[model samples]
Target: MPAASALVDLENLRHDVDDALDRHLTRLRDEVAATGPGTTALTDQVSTLLAGGKRLRAAFCYWSFRAHGGASSGAARDAVVRIGAALELFQAAALLHDDVMDASDTRRGRPTAHRVFEARHRERQWSGDADRFGTAAAILLGDLCLVACHREAGAALDALPTDVGRAARDMLDAMTSEVVVGQYLDVLVQAEAWGLDPTADEDRARLVLRAKSARYSVERPLTLGAVLAGASPDRVAAISAAGLPLGEAFQLRDDLLGVFGDPEVTGKPAGDDLREGKRTVLVARTLAAGDDDARLLVTKHLGDARLTDDDVAALRAAITGSGAVAGVEALIDELAAQGLSALATADLDAHGREVLTGLAHAAVDRAA
Candidate 1:
């Protein structure tokens, strides 16, 4: 296929995934409504949250299946789309829980789910602490999304060969386990930063990146697709090798954006990561390379929830002056090059190669 047509095909696949999610969510909402009107709010919240992402996970899964000689049409292609939708639903659950954990105020340019629920409580004049109510509701909603994820993925897997189904399910299970563990580590890192030794900062940050973001965001999704396509172990390994570095680069870029990206582009407040005291790779690098003054600046303001605009500006200056941003950019370039090289050498179809290459660039080089 021509490059333009290949790009069009990928876009169409993304739309199909969206349509699948819509249909699934509609069915869920209707089912819940039959149980109780109040219970349907969970589905409503998830549907709204799932509507706005770039769907990068789905694209990676779709193209990876194509790369592994999966059928392009009929029930096989539709099953892949369903799997993609399942990934999206799982992601939504993660994001909802993550926002609550981070005390995040916004997501995809809208109020976070917990905050939305809190506002709803206030609006209704409910008889409880609005914040607590919101947090509880968001947590339940996240759990509901997880159940939905399993249901969606199970149905898709049922259509695959037994071995492929087993492998895909295993990948999904691993992805979820890694993300949850990563999130716990993230919480621990922040809570223990003061007591922990500074020397392990970079290592800890990389560990969190791999677990919380990298594998689920790219590597596992690609491998899951390959598995569903009945690719050999060697093929899955090669795709994962390519995907891991790309996934790392993707999270590194996200770390950069979390600290320095424009709120308009990133759909979050500027300096939100700093406010939350996220021990990102950039911050670790800055701490390692910065002078005493820079270290003092970070110590004073890194986790200050009441940070003023001036404080944020000063912290930004300290981070920039430490050259950590430059270091991360260099790392991103290096990792991206490694990933592209792997893709170039991998035994994939010409169109799959082209789309995966584009996805690699999109993952690491986007503003959001």
Candidate 2:
């Protein structure tokens, strides 16, 4: 129907997913517009949320399909593209709800959806609390995106044989449910007290990080790709085994970026994790290793909303001075090595192994 690249190239895979997202959102826009023009903003906000993703999950799926010897241009490839777009939209839904939960101000260098909606409410002098309205609207937007994700995945699966499709859909459902549960785990960890036992804190943080990020971001996608490609249970397991470690390293990099990354590049403010008092592994390690003064700095400033530039600086100093940064970096390197070693164990073709090796580096070595 339209000119498109059907190759399995990574960059082209991103473009193909974007095209699918555009098609899905166009349908969403038309459907929403049918209700009324006022509802268009909901679709618009979802659109905004979908922009600027790294599409690492999509890449994993696409290449996993390729790695499993799935065809480059055919029904399977197209189905994987739809599934990739579904993953990206699902990620969008997660971000929408996550920002509201974290009370975040920015995403991908733009004001967050809730914040944007809140500003619109204030400007229009809406009656209710602007903050509450924003939260409600953003939540509903996330729900809509979640629905769209399922629909896309279902449609993509329809093209395959029934049994394979059913299993892939099961994987999709598991990924979705696991992420929600993991998010709740994250919330639970953040709300309760910590620092009593560094071991417990690190264990809890690892659980949250793996559930909320590692599995969803990498392992599930890779496993799902293998499933969609009609790989056997053992093959799927192998893919997940290889992907999980890389996923952990990826999230660890994200945790590092949260505290030390530039706002301009990361699209979130500096010291975001510190201000949020994430109780991350980094924080846990700092508490374990820091001198009393560094520990005091962490206790005083972590999660303080009124934190200033100087306060952020001091906190950063404390974290680095405590040696958590280097510790985390070393851990990241170790995990990356483990993932690559696992990948080597998989019976991948040469090209597949090469691509996956590249992706492992890209996932773990990124700045954003």
Residue pairs with backbone overlap in model 1 = none
Local distance difference test values of all predictions, in order:
0.87, 0.88
lDDT of 2 by residue, 267-303 (tens): 9999988877787999999999999999888987898
Please list the residue runs of candidate 1 whose C-alpha ends up more than 4 Å from where it truly belongs after superposition.
Answer: 1-11, 194-198
lDDT of 1 by residue, 146-177 (tens): 88888999998898778878888888998889
lDDT of 2 at 361: 83
Scored against the true structure, residue 136 in model 2 reaches a CA lDDT of: 93
lDDT of 1: 0.87
**Best of the candidates, lDDT:** 2
- The alpha-carbon RMSD values of the candidates against the true structure, listed in the order shown, are 2.1, 3.3
Consecutive 10-residue window with the lowest summed lDDT within model 1? 1-10
